[model samples]
Target: MNPSNQSPNHTAEDESQAVVTRRIQRLSLHLMAISAQNYDLCIVSCSSRGKLEVDKAQLSRYMRGKHREIQERVFEYFNSRPDLQTPVEILKDDHRELCWRQLLGLVREAGIKPFKYVAEDPAQYFAIAEAVGSVDMSLGIKMGVQYSLWGGSVINLGTKKHRDKYYDGIDNLDYPGCFAMTELHHGSNVQGLQTVATFDPIKDEFIINTPNDGAIKWWIGNAAVHGKFATVFAKLMLPTHDSKGYSDMGVHAFIVPIRDMKTHQTLPGIEIHDCGHKVGLNGVDNGALRFCSVRIPRDNLLNRFGDVSRDGKYTSSLPTINKRFAATLGELVGGRVGLAYSSVGVLKIAATIAIRYSLLRQQFGPPRKPEVSILDYQSQQHKLMPMLASTYAFHFATANLVEKYSEMKKTHDEQLVGDVHALSAGLKSYVTSYTAKSLSVCREACGGHGYAAVNRFGSLRNDHDIFQTFEGDNTVLLQQVAGDLLKQYKEKFQGGPLTVTWNYLRESMNAYLSQPNPVTARWEGEEHLRDPKFQLDAFRYRTSRLLQSVAVRLRKHSKTLGSFGAWNRCLNHLLTLAESHIESVILAKFIEAVQNCPDPSSRAALKLVCDLYALNRIWNDIGTYRNVDYVAPNKAKAIHKLTEYLSFQVRNIAGELIDAFDLPDYVTRAPIARQSDAYAYYTQIVGF
Candidate 1:
């Protein structure tokens, strides 16, 4: 049967394609709508329903003509908001709540709904967001809960039947739940979890219990207040076997209900506590949980990938227990993607604030003389423009990554899975960490007023910092990617041709021994980095070589020490290598996407931004690139010139830069970002 003809509930190829296409269209429209509302600094553009004629031609021109104009339009749009004109103090307390509320309103107003069971109807959930043209699911999920009045639910990865039975309920939000895995003392180490689930064959139940205080689940979102059910991970044991015979059969997942809806109280043997007042994401209601001899039906065991029979026989689809655990850990890739998208959203907000403020606020000129916009200053440009460039780089990379994620979801191939996992881990680490750091830099660029709550920069920075830790700690995530690279390196050298290994050995040695090459003095105006074919090849080669070198070293090192020992010994270096590799990929992806864009001006500006991004990295890692012959001394000079040129070009387009973000007025209305016209009105009202 044609996949398209299949029911929306089933896997249909045609349906998937249609869904993807529609999403692209919706996203384009949303971008266009935002562009129209933000084109002029004087007019306020609010809701999606606002009647504004988006000049496709002008937009096309802006995209093709000059990069700075794109920056300018973005700033101009953000500058029109009055609420953005308010101080930060008044905004912080309400920021999360307001964002949450606005998101909920958007869902209802747009008639969009979230899937009740994400695992079962993941496509539906993906489609809804694609249709809305927003990637931040946190807002959508929060709103979906309020509109549906259905509590959140958890998806089981252990068994297919578990998914079949409970997934529908979850997809509909009929039973909102939490996935409980991490123990208080054994985070990221699933094999070390102490919570146990012993089979009671006679009773056909599994007795779940936390053996000690350390066995209690911590950092479980929706556990403290919202969740009624949980997909609990526990160590499986058989009590009938003598003292020495009770073996830990690795971590297993079971669907267990924790609270009774009627009384709104914890069920027997279940305890929960709120994690109260976090640094951010307060709306999530995170908390800890414990189970004392909680009995659940044997059928509750989530055994899609592994299972236990009612008679107490254990079985698994995969032979290796570690692989099973790894499979479960892989589920967090979705969260990582979500995190990357959120980082982009936060970056957009930061860029909007910085760019708008740069264009609107002026200082340090003669009295009664026309003051220059702060953006015109080389110092200010250096501070915010690189970040602006980063925003575009992040945007392009995220879009491509998300598309790849969806494609991989279709086949469930292990290689695809591993790739997605690796990429997500790296991108999440890079984007969140950089966004957090860059947002603060942008805030500082705005001076004391930037610290004022009215500017939104401080709040945005705080909100984004959580991204670095959530899903997975950025440090830990990079380690995982590095580990994967190391594993690949070992495989390539161990059983493969010596030629491959030799090539890698040669490159690594060259990198270690080579001196800096003279920098290229080629001047192609601001479009040097925009040379479509050249940028593409450069990025591709750099990324491929970086990964190859790291993989080769990891492989070679494993020969001297055991896998685990080698990983531990070279851990720091691996992390550094992983970061370098990820950054290369990001730059490459950004350059690729921008070069392919139809607009010449947008391409040129994007090129400048790309150059800045690359140059900044080159400057930071001058020694490494110099040693490898990747960057010559003369090329270093080019890097500096590119940076200066980009800063200059971006200064003029500060207004337009903010426009590209397409934020509504309500979100950007902080006081310092307001335009001259609005400032006049505001000052008049204050009788200044």
Candidate 2:
């Protein structure tokens, strides 16, 4: 917009904020020149007049060069694939079969197989798949089910024999598979499943059976038509010498061939039925299966941690039954981590659509003057800017998660594994929950136009809604995170420099114990918001206070209700505590990213985003902060104003901030957000 057309009410603060935006862009080239190791420490002195030195060359790379290449490849892959271009807005069972097969062919042509990623790096490959999700989450989920779930299980839970046997076909989509862990009677409670795998010594085989109707596997993706095999989770039933029973052995996975590859018919004793149309992502062939004594070779079991001897003895490398259970559960983190990564991908699409539309869309205006873009409106700014900030926050958090998981997968470090499990659980729940709320906001921000599928907002929303429940239910996952935090608190886990959660806890404890008046020493307003340590302290204090409150409540109630009863009663509060801890983790990552940018301009821009994230979160929970005496009413007011200031700072840089995400026009495809003149193309199509 022309500066002359600005409202007379526009003030000095708005102009200064605009300068901050330009100043941030100025350092981008210098930042790009800095080595990755020293990028974080890139600090430059202000000129005598306090103006930033502007450089036109592109220096700062928002993402790693390789990852940026990966993102562009995803956009290119979708745009160039004619098979995938067909609108899947609607499809019947038969059409879905064709769509699924077409999807397989397109992926093959793109060379985006799950096995290719598995061979390179499990964690990194999963992250890249998530990046691909911004275009089509259904395909992402289908691939996730094949590679991340089915292929993931083989790699993580199975031995070399299983990997060598299935990896080739899985990556090539030759031996398509389904992961059937969720039963009709059980979604979150795996141990409660009643499917039994009985050992038949005479036949030297394991008979997989559904003991009752409730044991049937429900929502098994790729089972309706595409999948020929399934990774089945069932109770390992063994003959007892005395009063011991089969349920005593717990759950184990078996490689069950569901359908005959040639006939495309269900194996004898296995009843399969389609789950039918879902709220969204109908492209996946989800089905249910009931096994009536379906027998398979004993060697079909994916034996890495556990095995059955020739003499019919069951033994495991894991120390205890719980450890065995946890080992299996731990391998599933790849999916959760990918879900979190994909949640950010989804958020980027929503923000891009909303922000670009608002910029071009003009509405009511001053008398005898040109109408203003909706983006100039405070309401639109308030709605879209914070969501944009959050998408960036999730991006950094996911990158951190990917690195941690990759490191853990390589070294098999127990501490890193435990941390990854705990982190993925909380991050997945938190990121998906935020994405759901933010996507709705983005949709509503676009007015009635957003409701139409052609705009892509409605479909994106529908497809992503399942993310809250799938992989793992967000609510149940948060509870597990709470349980983990409580365990960490009780154990008082020690933290070194790199240990995230425990390190935050340790700092909080030190502040409460060592510092007589930590709050008194705190800087006011922008100074406090800009300090990385201050943000960490704010997050840590809130988390610690909530954790302490939970401990007290549990202690008080447990005497009468018992530990289980107390825990059940306090689940809601525990969820909040976990939420606060996760917010802290996110803030810490954003801070790290902010501190590490070597270019002054780039660092300045990122700080604005990080500050906005921290301030907005703290503002939302101002009541909680006040209740704990963490912030005075006056201090809270300053924090609120700082959020507004940060919002304006972001407003000036909003276009460039999204440009940093680098989504091409081809992938977005919305006429309103087209790379060419969006208004001209839109008017040409609609004749408006």
Candidate 3:
């Protein structure tokens, strides 16, 4: 008998269901670990309770198991209490002092020790964030979101020791620190930074100065009002190496005190001012910083990777400056991953609101003049279900990526580290951009009410809009991934033996040219297109073929045109291919989990979700198929049929869909999404 056939002694289900149940339990455990890392103490506390209670019976009845319902109930219970809910309201009520106080409270709760003077221990901060679910980090990120646009870096990219010293008091709300790296003229090119740290051998100190206004740090988060210290990145100039020229001695980190604790005045060489507010995240006082002739102890330098001796000689364990810089860049990967998860959180909140509202708000049609819920409409299902599916997709993908990232860190695999970094950057760009767009669509799906601040969609949109640009702009990040892919293609193909690339090229060419393959249609029955596995395979094949074709085309183009020109010409196509690859990865992972679902009802619901995800992509890429001879007109008709079928299937599952999200009534705070009885009662009370 297959292992799946083995029955649990207590339950009467067959082996297949048992296996799926076990798989779900395993996956749930995995999710719990991720939640522990991503959520604060409050969130983790609630989620832990829910996880313990999730059961098959509950899962069958509601798309979400009992655990999810418990999670929702917990939210409802908490939000009903004035104290917890009051803080959220007050924080939103005032964007200044009250908000800061609330933020301080959250920071403390998030494990920042009170009365501390600095954030010298970055790991402790990360540990606290992990322990508390990063609520404070989110607040910090939100504060920096808008400010980052003007150029301040909120998340510090510094070593453990540097954080221990300069960041020590910040945890206790004592001495706040800002991250300063980008110069007015330098932007993303850290290599071109002109801030210099010269060795003063006589005094045994490092003299730090900005060569000009262009070299001044233009955008340092929390600099204008909050920060009293900074983690400054600069070029190290050796005293005796004057004749050797500035040979890229690698970027070194340093701690510089910039403000007087008692007077709150700028130190002798440091100047600061607030950056005026604009689009969003205006609460943070992002500002500019100028360093004149600031002198700090030689030991103030963060000497983890590179260090200077008292004699003014510089030495580094890493020989290559480029590799060292890349290593520094590597530290920012976590932020990118964090941003990806944050984007998912934003979407979750939006979907919860939209789904609940859809189930409550009623409109036209009559059964003895009864109003039908908006979710009853197929059009609404088409608009919202794909996004709902995508939330799960992103959730699963990010969880998996985080797992891979943790494993790589543990093993210290350089190649794995680089790959995760590149992948995280691309995925962050893809997920956040889509989530932002989807949230807008979900907002519109809610109609006029969605635009109201009280409805929460508008605020959610405003808050998430900045995610697209930060953690490196989406366009720039994706372009980097494309560049990496192109390099891989060249390395594999440009050499003497082109075995792998040639084989991929041949297979893709055959598929594109419409050569008949048995496996291609094996899964396609009269209703094959409707089969969830068939749809998944289609995404897989389509993505693989697209990537192969693009890689080959770029390679061929490189032979004739200059490398730069060829890359420029192929940029759009390459990025699209990467997007398709990512989509396929997400779809594949979602399908694997869905296939492992034990409850038949859940399997059915997830199947519809899977179909909706695939159909959405097909709709977006209809032109691609239309231009290709491989896809027949009949196949095009099949795509539309799949869309219509999935749309109807989604409508049937909308109530169940909302249940799967498990949003609490209080967090939603939308009258329409509340239970119908409550909605009616509230409407009456308000005289609506």
Candidate 4:
């Protein structure tokens, strides 16, 4: 980054350092993977199959079929129209308000109505919503805030009366709505909100009041210029029988109109203003709002779980206060799951751009030889191929999550709700964290041209940065997942059977306990690397051991700290547990996807991506192979070598692998990725 280091020769200098740095770093890990005995677990390296050309024809149909077909149609339709293209183009231009309005109008026109699709085919509906993120997170988020957040509240929490009033219009995007939840002082801590909705007996209405500056709704999409209403989350101030104002009935959702539909103006008591320019999602028109004793009909409460009567009496069918709160929250998991799943699509776009650019961008090679594609370097492959592998991993994991969510909607099972919440929270945090890193890596992978706006990596890097914080902050979501996981672990300790699927924690615990003493851990080499069962054994064993260690740590911490304090102290360890579980889930789900694949060619290609994912993760966290002797330390070194070997294997098919994402030029929108046209494209655009 030194100014004097900004010459063409410096590029090769930096690339050399990067390659050497990776070697030094891995050599350090190599020792960690080798125990005092230097035990190693690498068989024949990548000898399972001879150089098989990646099945490009099958890969073209890799992510195809009905859902992809559906996505393509929607993408083509929404992307084709002149007006719709204008909003995306205007995203980088001035007049942020105009861009958001254009987005809202086009969301309606494109029939990206989340509420409409949720009632019929929810997965497809969610898919279309996610497909939007692949193109532009700004527009996707605007559309999602309206239908998924605002209208989703009505569908999930409201009875027939509320649905009849809002569902039809919400479906067609006739009304733009926002989910008013986070306050200036409260975001992840929904329970700490200061906004109060007091029951007024005189008018039989609820008075929504923002008592202080901190209580003002902040970062609300659609409120700046477009939304007419919001599904507001606030404390319910219900009077007790003793006439005391408010009970501890907790936070609830209420339908509050913020703007006059025709005028698009803030209502009398609703103070609204734009949040001004932000780092990304510029077209979202984010704004803040403060309510001053705004009154709405008592029925405005989305009262499927809790309600107030004409006499201002609070009521609910949920057996316990906890049940009522959980049920209400159950209605909102879709947002988390949607974001988690949607991240996969976004990651795909990023991976496509980075990989394509790497393949096209060449650098120093052997003396007197032609320059090599950057991807041909082990250092460059290390940067992008793993991210590509994770994109595939998340793709299957999130797909399964979407189906589980649909089942939860149908059955309304509390058990499923709890599990889904945990899974989605973990996946959302892990995937987005991975994605944020991927965008930056992708941007850097392209070197200088990556910073160019026309290549799309710059906007993508900026836009994806916020995705880590929203939906739910990554750290908070991971903590929640960790907490949920620990609860299950505790239940198992109390003699209750553990109930996790595929990546079975209980069975893993039993296996680890039975083999407390290490056997001569002989890794049969590269052939064993191709065994999904062998990979799962390593992953599952690590997760089980980490969970056990974390449990012990928490128990020990409890002796000195209060429950919350003990938990707070163990947050980092808990995150480790959550991450371990997530990595296992990603691996298990990917293996399953390939095993269940009917197409031999596609399966063969996906198998390489899957192996790369597993090996790459194990290599990076080589210490996972340490601590417990279930796997030998040298096996970790083997994993590192195998990952490098798998990287080469994946590199052979990198184009087809990315091509499987099916991102057309319009979707990728990166000039460098245009291969033969890169020079002409950047020349004309950059006026070089």
Candidate 5:
């Protein structure tokens, strides 16, 4: 819009509304000139110059789900504050300081108290976390460390005494703390940690110590500089009845003071070292810590599962150490849940940027005609359309996860807890791995422009790379999912009722235990391939077959090798099985979302994207389907064609699809992702 044409009262919101108005006008004019058959082609042509018409408000409402208002508030909060946005090429220390300030800004300025909401309102807290992550992941991690990890550990594991004494300070950031869990030698294997905390009966304190170099707490955020205290996880030791030595209990968490609050110096018995500059997320000051007999009162123990008396005798209701350990870690699964939620938001940013850029970037086309959008090219669509589809799929899946977690919190049902834990683990692994890989694909799709630091793909990719490693490594997490599935598989035979997540297993196993009928296997109609039922069934068949086959393989191998060796031999198959199960879960949730969508237009759009996601996944793994004769060659070809067809359908509405993400231009911080006037915005930002 021309500056001269604007009224004196014009605001940024007004200009944004004008852009949408102009795009819709353009779309309406083009639609009037085209027939139904040429509608998609017309959209492809019009998109180079203008946006396509979509019910963006309705779609955005649906995509944002229950937390739309909170998310929008966060996005607007950051969008209005230029100071909060990290400048390109800032020093590491400056970046870390910025992250800390940004987090504080969200609390003091935006009034987003994720720490309080962690227990009071989990959904809202995660919504805030995701929005913050979308704008700046450094801030996201910093917030997670302070609220979700450190503060959450105290709330979930510590009792009323801990909450009364510490909750107010942690909430106000007066007592900055870190979650000290991972050690130099322990990343995923928390049980193998070597740090020891022996109860001192004489002093009525727990003496924390790092027995060896490998036992030092490593990669602890908020430790090197900002943290004053730490929720240290160490093996609890009690004096044996003979008084000759100490008996080791399992891992336990204690509130150990790491630095003096007033002096801002490391405590006498504590040592801290900066982990140095990292490949990404340098805004977070990762650090390592070692304790030389750090002592804290016996009351410092987070004794929800176990505790020691003043005399140093330990007592717990849980009979076994393994149960105590499981219970301890289960309470801390919120980290994985938050990561899965935030990872989806990060993927949304990447998708919106890349897809919008593709629409703006015109390139080679047919002879004697104007250059066409790269998005119109079949190859480009192939690269990005399914990615867009999967983003939506993951959104709904994660939303369901968030809902389940909230439900578990309210009920504390044992089965519900296990379901939430397993679901979070699987989704975190699958989604982060996909998002990490997709960032590179997105960067490459944007060509050299993506490589430029100003575009943000570099920073986004770098910061998100660690997500797959932290919150439990992807490989280890997936193995846990597979193990959970195998347990349910065993229960199915014993006539035991399945949990809500794996309830379909009983029927699916019975049906898929036999081969699919010849007629159904060979059917190749577009309607058949696109059917949600058929897609879900295909996914279920793969998961069920893998479960059965892997079970047989494990049992056969157990004769020659012990159970551990058998599991090691079948690790690859187990990972695949776990991935298949997660894929099925995602598809099922996507279908449920489409079925329940209130707006017809939004539902139709979602159905198209769902088809693309389902068919793309099926086509990618066609080899397995073909091997079992589950889908004949002709049917497989049909699935491929329909997948491509659905991609084109999605490409027609790609603008609306991305807009539904509802990220402001400032939040994306990419010139190429501007909603309107791409050339003008790009040139102005680039000083061309």
Candidate 6:
């Protein structure tokens, strides 16, 4: 009867409906088969004998580090505004629109004038961005592109006139913009960027041009939809004094209007292309841009470090083009600092979810007994506890970086700028890469439940994966760190005073060169392994030794391989040294934090976590310690045993440790991350 009544289109429509019906039936059975497991019986059966006695809120405050109040304020603001939250299931364009709306709501309602804090209080600025990141990374980055990259460029790189002209609009989101630095072909190598800005002396204008497809600006946040202008970096070409041609005056930034504000249309000679769908962070509209003789007033150039006159004369306070480039980049160190903080936040969320779920989801047990919490299992503890310790360690380290950067801003110390830049580069690279990898570890640790998108491991992993490449690629950043280390190493031997970070280098190098004391090397006591002094000394030795070894290798190879070839040969060694130095810096910061903790209970608990962090790192690289005979076989074994023992100790306090992160249900948006009643929450959200 259906066939007889069916029209030509009706037959196809029915066939389509039949296919959908069959697919839905199959999916319904699959959901039933793999529905989230209920934790009611497990929760009831679990014993609570091993909970830590630390003050949870105090630990949270300590973990939040500096600008705790600002972070909390942001959290409260976001929590109260349910309308700002985007649904999990939406198209990319919708997600981008919602993210933009959230940004507008934040400015209009939350009064988060990030531009104000960028200069007056960068720590607060970073804290606000980190908090936004905890809610949604896309919003965090969009805010960054608007306030930090664009507005920060105006404030940091531009003159007072440029600031007066652009600051208000940028701060209020009236002129949403892009940080158009990276080009399609020149991502890490700014010196090679082909985009040119030629000054027109007669008209007093700079004509920006994209020489070819390769010169097009790429991966620019906010460029596709919202950005009206960009702080475009291009090779400055000033008209020659001889009246012959233009002189290449190196890379400089200029404010170029990309879209008409009232019409919301692409401006003439400025092309904008959507980057289309990405692996994640689809909420931010990333796009490519091309400039074909885009003309702007001569005053549009950000003239803090460098400037061009109305007559096409180029001037810079920095002595050389290299110095100018360095200064320009140094002013933007906040990006790396913010990313490091956000990466840590993401890691905290992942660790909290995985650890909490591990405690709730019970698995194998002996006969005639209640099943054990998965966290009770050694394998799970090994996976989650160390990450928990690292989260704390990175938190303290990033806080230190923020402090150093803030101090640099206040003092305007050239040394501090270099130090902040190097540290930011290293920490951003190290922490983001670690968090990127650890997301998967956390995902796997939670078993199949973590695979579900609602749990956030998938999106978190995909979104944070770029942290290794963007801002600065990890490899290049590490190389920069190594290069700086070598410069310091040379200075140390030449009787130059070392910076605060490198002061220990001389002593550590001396200690490494002298000898490995038999008594220290063979010391296997728990107290000895846990000693902050001993842990720091071991870390210092590793870094100093690596520095010396890499330096020697580079020098030896340069004789035969040439400088660039030698560097290529020693790239792996340089990376190791960079990582070792960054780790040592992080470990020292964690130790200082623990020592300074006023609460005895919190301090003791933190010491346990610190020991785990240090020993776990040492154990992971036991071969390095063993190769130099810095630790005896027995000592290495003891370190390994203590690592396991500390994991067990941390496992007992796992819930508290994660609870200290203080991510509310709204921020986590995962049913299993609930502090209490995760089972009921999981079933309710999954609707099974």
Candidate that would win on lDDT? 5
Better of 1 and 6 by lDDT: 6
- Note the Cα lDDT for every prediction shown: 0.63, 0.79, 0.63, 0.79, 0.91, 0.89
Measured by C-alpha RMSD in angstroms, how accurate is candidate 2?
11.0
| Cα-based lDDT at residue 673, candidate 3 | 60
Task: Give per-residue CA lDDT, model 2, range 313-415, as digits (tens).
Answer: 9889897778898998987788888889888888888898888888878997554557778876667878988888888888889888988887887898888
Q: Against the hidden reference, what TM-scores do the models get?
A: 0.76, 0.88, 0.77, 0.90, 0.92, 0.92
Residue by residue across 1-688, what tens digits does model 5's lDDT show?
Answer: 6888878899879889999999999999776555334645645654453433568899888888778888888888887888888897899999999998888888888887788889978888899999888878988999999999999999999999999999989988888899999999998999999999999999999999999999999999999889998999999999887857889899999999888889998889888999999999998989999999888999999999998998777889899899999999999999999999899999999999999999999996544567889998779999999999999999999999999998887889999999999999999999999999999999999999999898899999999999999999999999999999999999999999888889889877889869788999999988888899999999999999999999999999999998999999999999999999999999999999999999888898898899999999999999999999999999999988878777877888999899988888888988888888866877887687
Q: Residue 513 lDDT in model 3?
A: 38
* Candidate 4 C-alpha lDDT tens digits along 1-688: 4667677666867878999999999988876565322322221234355555666656656554457756776678656764555232454335455556545555556554456677566688777877777667777787788777888888888999999888877866777788899999999888888899999888999999999999999999878877899889998888777766458678889999988888877888999988988888887878899999899999899999988899977788986767887788777888888888887888888888889888988887644557878887778988888888888889989988888888888887767777788888888899888888888888888898888778787777777788788878999998887777777777776776554552376556677555634543557388786688878777777777777888888889899897788888888888888888888888888999898877787888889889998877776776656655555776667777778888877877788888877778777777887746877886877567
lDDT per residue, candidate 1, 549-600, as tens digits?
6556657778988777767777777777678667766776776766586666
For candidate 3, write residues 268-346 as lDDT tens digits.
9888866666455545556788888899998877776677888767777778888777866675566677677667767
**Model 6 segments beyond 4 Å from truth?**
1-52, 241-244
Q: Which residue pairs in candidate 4 collide?
A: 33-633, 33-634, 42-525, 43-524, 43-525, 43-526, 44-526
Ranking by TM-score: 5, 6, 4, 2, 3, 1
Instruction: Give the clash count for model 3.
Output: 22
Per-residue lDDT of 395 in model 5:
95
In model 1, the runs with Cα more than 4 Å from the true position are: 1-110, 116-172, 239-243, 366-368, 493-566, 674-688
Candidate number of the best TM-score: 5
| Model 2: residues with Cα > 4 Å off, grouped in runs | 1-60, 243-247, 493-499, 513-523, 683-688
Instruction: Select the stronger candidate by lDDT from 3 and 6.
Output: 6
What lDDT score is found at residue 479 in candidate 2?
Answer: 91
Cα lDDT, model 2, residue 121: 71
